[model samples]
Target: MYVGQGGLIMTEVVGMVFIIIGIPFFLSGTIGLLRLPDIYTRLHALTKADNVGLGFVILGLAIQATSWLEVAKLFLIWFLVLVASATSCHLVADAALRRNIKPWTKE
Candidate 1:
């Protein structure tokens, strides 16, 4: 049935799907952080989770937003998150390298 002028029911369904997909990425990242054997590997998990999880969350929010202003705000927030997370991760990795943290070597 039609829920609203802008198809609220469909939008809500898509938003739910996006949120559900994002949850798995977040969970996988957490697991990686706990289980990975090295700092580099852990960084991989963090980056993947940060990008995918934020992307999905933002997409879901955008789908549900009824106004262009709200959607633009959501996009701006996502962009900021992406930049911040990537830059922070890079700095952390560089610091670890400078401190001589040993990387995993294939034996």
Candidate 2:
């Protein structure tokens, strides 16, 4: 059997691990959205989860890729995800701040 033949099993395991790790982050973000007292805090959770989830997913993909071309594609995907997520998060936060959405207090 070829390395690529066993690669499928390895890829499946890695993908599953990434998904499992990402689930907690995603769920935490959802919970924060529901439980957080304000928009800023909710945005924090959202951005954190988005970054973490993308990181894990990209790591899994990188592990699975065998060729230089495949790895380059994964790198591009990771870069795109990072840029998009950060830009979106910044935009949302900026919009909220501009609109004067108050942050939560510990009191």
User: Each prediction's Cα lDDT score?
Assistant: 0.88, 0.78
Highest lDDT among the candidates is held by which one?
1
Q: Please list all clashing residue pairs in model 2, or write none if there are none.
A: none
Please provide TM-scores, in order, for all candidate models, with all chains considered together. Answer: 0.88, 0.72
Off by over 4 Å in 2: 1-16
Clashes of each: 0, 0
User: Residue 99 of model 1: what lDDT?
Assistant: 97
Q: Over the stretch 9-105, how does candidate 1's per-residue lDDT look in tens digits?
A: 8888899899788888888899999999999889999987868888998899899888999999999998888888889889999999999999998
Please provide, for model 2 over 17-102, each residue's C-alpha lDDT reduced to its tens digit, 9 standing for 90 to 100. 87677667778878888988887887788878867876776777677677889878977987887788789888988998899977
Kindly give the stretch of ten consecutive residues in candidate 1 with the minimal lDDT sum.
1-10
RMSD of each: 2.0, 3.2
